[model samples]
Target: YYNAIMACGLDSQDALEIFRLCIYDKQFIDTATLKDSQMQLKGRAASGVVFVANAALSVASITGDMSVVSEVITDLSSIGAKMNSESIRHIVRALGNIGDCEMILALLICLRGQDFANDLM
Candidate 1:
């Protein structure tokens, strides 16, 4: 399911939105699904990481639990995913969706070091 969702191109955002609505209840999240998503995103590029993170953030938004989101971040960090400008945008939006102000601020700070503050302006 996670792979299929990630494979979606132009419809990815819409699919994720619908998935978020369907899984608004925490019961919809299970150990198997979480592992499946993790496996699908493991060793992927930064865009794939962002894709999976966006989905994870949607789940976090619904359940108000950061466990999955944290795991995704940890996996990405360990692998040092090659993030590009677009990847940063997706991650920021995901963090914002889940109201992760601390992470968002941290990301902004990192971007500032990369001289993207002007772009934000």
Candidate 2:
């Protein structure tokens, strides 16, 4: 279901539906299913991070959930720290969708040592 969302390039609403289903539907996704997803997410490149981060931020913004925002920020920070120039560029673009000022600030701070900051101004 999550893979379908990624493959189809669905909008946030669609992606959120899948995310909710993944979180709530006990019969749909088991422990191993979730662990596999987590592993895949951890191994994803910058583009994948951008997609997931964007979806997470969108969900947080719409729901006004700070916890979700924080989680997504953490994921973005972790992935962004390891990405190369092209990946960082995707992350920067996705950052624009994030509504939380604090998250944006944190992302900026994390990007300081990277070359992407030079291109920002």
Candidate 2 error regions (>4 Å): 7-10, 33-41, 45-92, 97-105, 108-121
TM-scores vs. true structure, each candidate: 0.39, 0.37
Model 1 C-alpha lDDT versus the unseen true structure: 0.50
Across 8-104, the per-residue lDDT of candidate 1 in tens digits comes to 4445344454444434434444443555456643223333334445554444444444454454455446544433444455566657766889998
- Lowest lDDT sum, 10 consecutive residues, model 2, at 40-49
- Candidate 2 matches the true fold with a TM-score of 0.37
Best by TM-score: 1
The collision pairs in model 2 are: none
lDDT of 2 by residue, 1-121 (tens): 5364454352545555555554455554355354545654322333333444455444445445445445545544643323344434434445555455566678778778656465563
- What is the TM-score of candidate 1? 0.39
Instruction: Quickly count the clashes in candidate 2.
Output: 0
